[model samples]
Target: MSKEQIKLRSMIITALFAAIIGVMAQLTIPLPLVPITGQTLAIGLAATILGARYGTLSVLLYIAIGSIGVPVFAEFSAGLSVLVGPTGGFLIGFIPATFIIGLFLEKLGFTFKNAIIANIIGMLITLAFGTVWLKIATDLSWVSALASGFTPFLVVGTIKAILASWIGIIVRKRLLSAKLLISNDIKQSA
Candidate 1:
């Protein structure tokens, strides 16, 4: 395969990963205010596998598509209405979560310690943004917002982080190996 072929394959894979994230977002455990889903896990996987730039871009594209009337959000909600709705903060946090996680993945190479710490930090960032937005939108205090918006997500979020981190490291390694193998083949052919 040539360079162009590699680029094309990467782009396609990234898009498919993003699409998987979108579909995962729809598998919600219904909550009163913000539904819980496996979307964050997908975000973490994308960041760890795709690195900062493309990972962030993939997440942003997912948000954009869901915000523009695509039925990609939890519970099938879509459009600008969902973007500005009460759960919007969590939606927005996806960008930073993926970006920051990818940063750690790139810099620290996803060792067990780094994966644990990075996942914690990334999730904290997501919670911060989500709670702040929830408070502002609902006229709740910080504690109340956290109680309502972030607390319920605690257990499941932790589990997702652990699972995603483990899976992400493996997936990243595999993808990197595939990339190297493809490059070596192309070089030999050339």
Candidate 2:
């Protein structure tokens, strides 16, 4: 493929992942504060499959669409209000979380072990960001924030982390084998 074709392919995949994130965001187990959604899992999948730069791009695209009132966030919430809402930090945290997940995979190779570690770290980062913002936004005590935002998600997050790791590695390897994803360090697929 030419340079333009490669760029276009990557762009399409990035946008597709953004849409996937939106779709996954709808899968929510509602809680009082921040609900558990498939977003973090999708983020992990994006990172594992797309690598650092493009994975971050996918997340940025997802956030951008949601910020523009696309209703792409958890529970179909959207707009700048959602971005600055109590759970906004979690959305913003996705940027770093996605980047770090892909970065770790890029550095350590896209193995199940490394993906698990990366996803676990990413999950904690999201929880921390959301918990702090929840406290500040809701004027709750740190204890309350932890109770509602952080503590509630631990078990589910670990489960999602493992799933993201296992599924991500499998999909990534298949895509690589199929030449659908960019191979090695020379370029990115999406």
Best-fitting candidate, measured by lDDT? 2
Segments of candidate 2 deviating more than 4 angstroms = 186-190
Q: Tens-digit lDDT track for model 1 on 50-135?
A: 76777788888888888888888887778988877778888899889888987776676656556666777777778878888899
User: What TM-score against the true fold does each predicted structure earn?
Assistant: 0.89, 0.96
Residue lDDT tens for model 2, 1-190? 7879888889999999999999999999888788899999999899888888999999999999999989999999999999889999899888999999888888777888888999999999989998888999999998999999899889999999999989988998888888787755643323
> Which candidate wins on TM-score?
2
Worst 10 residues of 1 by lDDT: 181-190
**How high is the CA lDDT of each candidate model?**
0.77, 0.89
lDDT of the structure predicted as candidate 1: 0.77
